[model samples]
Target: MPAPELAAVPGSQDPAPAETGTSRPTATSTGAPGGDAPLGFTGAGTGEVSSGSPDAAAVEEPAAPAEEAPPSTQDSPVGSEPAEGAPATREEVPTAAPTAPAATPAEPTATPAEPAGSAATTSEAAAPAESTAPADSAAPTDRAEPTDGAPSSEAAAPGEAAAPGEAAAASEAAAPTDGAAPTESPTPTPGPRPAPSPSPRPRPTPRRQVPTPAAVAPAAAAPSVVAPVDAHDAAEAAAWGRVDDDGTVYVREATGERVVGQYTGADTEEALGFYVRRFLDIQAQLALFEARLAQITPKEIDQTLATLTEALAEPAVVGNVDGLRERLEKLRSAAGERRKQAAAEREAARAQAVAERTVIVEKAEQIAEQDPARTQWKQSGQRLRDLLDEWKTAQRTGPRLDRPTEDKLWKRFSHARTAFDRHRRQYFSELDATQDQVKAAKEKLIARAESLSTSTEWGRTAATYRELMDEWKAAGRASRKDDDALWARFRAAQQKFFDARSAQNAEIDAEYGENLKAKLALLEQAEAILPVTDIKAAKAALRPIQDKWDEAGKVPRADVQRVEGRMRAVEQAVRDAEQAAWKRSNPETKARAEGAAAQLESAIAQLEEDLAKARNGGDAKQIADAEAALEARRTWLDQVQRAVHE
Candidate 1:
């Protein structure tokens, strides 16, 4: 069998001693005896790396001389035995360090001693075969030096002797592989042992290695271990992430599972809880965004979506990553729909605002169109102001209107107001002109009334006052402020004239009061001549009384009716008396009376004779006839006697 290969342990090197005229061995095969296997390492460098060290290619560059490192605990026996029954002394050596001095070929090579009990297991052939080789004969054989970080195959354990059969096989295998002889080492010559130097043993430097159970001995030290997960936590982890026994953490996604983090502390539950909380935070943000979709603008929501998408792209949290992506996509769609709806609402509001503003403008226009003469100016003006206020309010509270629409409405409103104001000014101007004319006419009438008010010519002045009042009535009304003052002055002047007339009439009434008594006395005298026995005397008396009544003239107005009525009655009586006297004095009337009286007297005398006859005869029929005749004659005779007496 060929010699077993020996590789240097990580952080350690076995150096070759330098010798004069020694040739370095050339390696026919750097590969392992078996076919080289692939080590499936994907991180920190190339393939085929040792478990304890990096690949040789990574450190092939020449390095500066380094301090020797302590021997690795990984080195093991290569020839299968240790030398001289003493444990080998292991010293630290650094890889790529400068060489130490080698033992001289003339003297025996000093090998590390071996443990006493271990040497007994060796084959007895190993000792004799090692003792046969001459040290000087070995000088011609090439010694293999490690180069290009290649491992040395023939290296043996310190103080270990090789197996004779394997040494022969190695020599046979090396014969044609290279034209060099087999290397030989001289057997050690037994001699008195030299005493070890009195140097204190070096203390072992603590080596860093994979922690074992003993490493947790410190009171404060704790081991890194994954906590046992409950069923609920296990389910949660199945949905969110997976925890490996080595504390590696993975997040599950649709694409596949991916390494996200690791748990370095003892508790795996806390580590998983931390990542779960991060997922909850992200979920909370998404829920809040969904709720406020209407409040935030489309542009703002789009920006938030972009930010969230980027944040979730390579999420820090452990959860259903594919589910989160689906949720975000739905949110984006919802936001898009909301943006479209918002746009529609804005358009509708703008249209409504325009319609409302138009209505206000039309109302103002209608108010302005009303004729100022017929319009209730106060109410109309107030309505216009209210319409303007309404317009301003709509602008403030309603949606924004397009500029052209707003401007057009404003123009109409302004024009209406301007027209209304112009009409109002014109109407007041005409009213003022009319008032001026009326005031002029009233002033002239007032002046004329004052001129006639104090005149004492009662009849003429009264007529002039009546004429002035008629003129005042014909004059149009002035403004109330001027009219009231002018009217007061005119009325006072007229009152003065009427008051003077009343006083004058009162004084005349007192003067005529005595005349009323004299006229009453004269009326009594005239009334006394009623039964006129002497016509000429009655006439003469009445003539004088009538003349005196005329002289009495005007009486007090209260007494005029009584006195004049009495005097009229007396005049009617006197006329009736004169008619009677005339009848008595008239020739025709007297003749008619004398003839009737004479006829009645003759009839009476005849009837008296007939009556005497009837009385002497005592015949009833004849006597009744004679008596009726006699009564009729007596009645006629009495009427004739009265007429004759008159």
Candidate 2:
């Protein structure tokens, strides 16, 4: 028999449940039935882990120390006894911690005080000894320090004292060996007195023990503080972890069950319930992570995934471990999807940025290519600058386009802006030069006009003013505003001179009206000579009329050109007739005319001969040329004859 921590009741058999040493969080023992009681978790350290995945949860490194331990969590009914046909076994429940000082070995008694270190059960049936040791869970063992130098088996021989360092098989029953005569086993030595309340007689268990009842409540003063899990977590706890009769705790995994340390608490159910609550907490964390999946980056997800992966690998918890892993896998898949979605979004943004840059470049080019003569320089230039600003803004805020694409757009935009600036400067420079020339020319004209404004030599001055007005019309315009002002000054100066001339003419105009009427009558008489057949008569008649026109003279200023022009027409007709008459009277002139007519007649005769030769030779172009030359010569001969006759 081993001195286990779970101490037993005085006499009734059916082995007592175990006591375990676990690094659980601080808790207040509920001391409920089963073995270890439900604990009120303090949440100060490890026991603060919820009933579920304890190892997987983020918790403080410090493990909670045990608060209290009652000898028996199970309350024995009054007058209860061992089953009549059942084996009379003594379950050695562990009563003290492994760190407790070696118990003072006590004298033998009918019902021994169970040792304080390890747990053991001695089956003393009437049949030969048969010991049952369950398949051990990987859960850690709590053993006592050895008193003897030699090692011993789990079931000691009759009269042997409880050996130290021997772990009692958990959740298993024991009986005498088959065919061996029944032997009465020595009673175990009384060990350290365990302060315990009375407990019910434990039922005999088979090799594979059935599940135990819920842990009974501990004394109210039980020292450990345990955080309470929602009662709903118990089902989840059962799904992942279980406690053997000897108090070995295990967590179920996909690969099979593995140890998660012993549950030194009240009972199997309470132990599993504690870890189940922890699993729920971790599950909560998963839910939160899922909620934040959109906001967090893929890298953040990877880190969290790695952390959760490590947590789930060897967690101290009870729940669906495989389910948690599945959740982790789902999270990973979601992260991948998020990465793809984000990439797509970035690509779309980049494309939009590229399009925007292209628009800026195109607009700048349009401004640059406008005709400098017609361009609205101020507005167009400002628009280019605005486009540049837009480009900068897009660069700063929009997703990055490929370097090559961005650079290409920038070059185009910059080139266009530069070209536009150069064009604007050049256009303004030329306009300035042109405007300077116009101002200079106009200034000279204005100076000349101002000097001429006071001239009173009416006839000569009027002729000079006509010349000045003609020069002004020949000069091109200046800028509208400057030209308009300059023109007004020039008109005022001219008008002043014209007004003086007009006033003087007003008095003379009546006298000039008579002169104008006389000139007009003389013009009619002279113009009648235009159709004259007799050269001598036309010349003699026009000479008299022109003489009379000269004497009449001085028409109104407005009528002067009109009168003079009509007189000139008549004089020109007379002069033309006289020149012809004079030429006809010259001996040399008649001789030349006769000679030219005779030559043309002779040429026409030669052309007729050439035409006949061309026709004979079938040369179509030569024949046509000969015929044209003959016709021209004949026409010239007729004109010479007519002139000589006239």
Q: Rate the local accuracy (lDDT) of all candidates.
A: 0.50, 0.52
- Could you tell me every candidate's TM-score relative to the true structure? 0.43, 0.42
Q: How well is each residue in 1-646 modelled by candidate 1, as lDDT tens digits?
A: 1111111101101112222222111100011111011110111000111111111111010101112121112111221111211111112111221122222111111111111111111111111101112111111101222232222111211112332223222322332111112222223222222243253221111122111213212210112121222445334644678666644556778888765543322245544543454455456567788899889987889877875675466553467767767888999999989999988998998988888888988898898899777988889999999998999899999998889889999999999999999888898799799889988888888788888877899999898888888888888777889889989988998998899888888899899988988997887788788777777888898998999999987987677788889888877877887787777777787678789988988887887888788889887888899889878878877886787667
Task: Tell me the tens digit of each residue's lDDT in model 2 across 243-358.
Answer: 77645557778799866443443456656665565456556667777899888876788776765665565555578878977998898899899888878878898888888889
- Tally clashing residue pairs in candidate 1: 12
Top model number, lDDT: 2
Whole-structure CA lDDT of model 2:
0.52
Off by over 4 Å in 2: 1-234, 243-250, 258-278, 285-304, 456-646
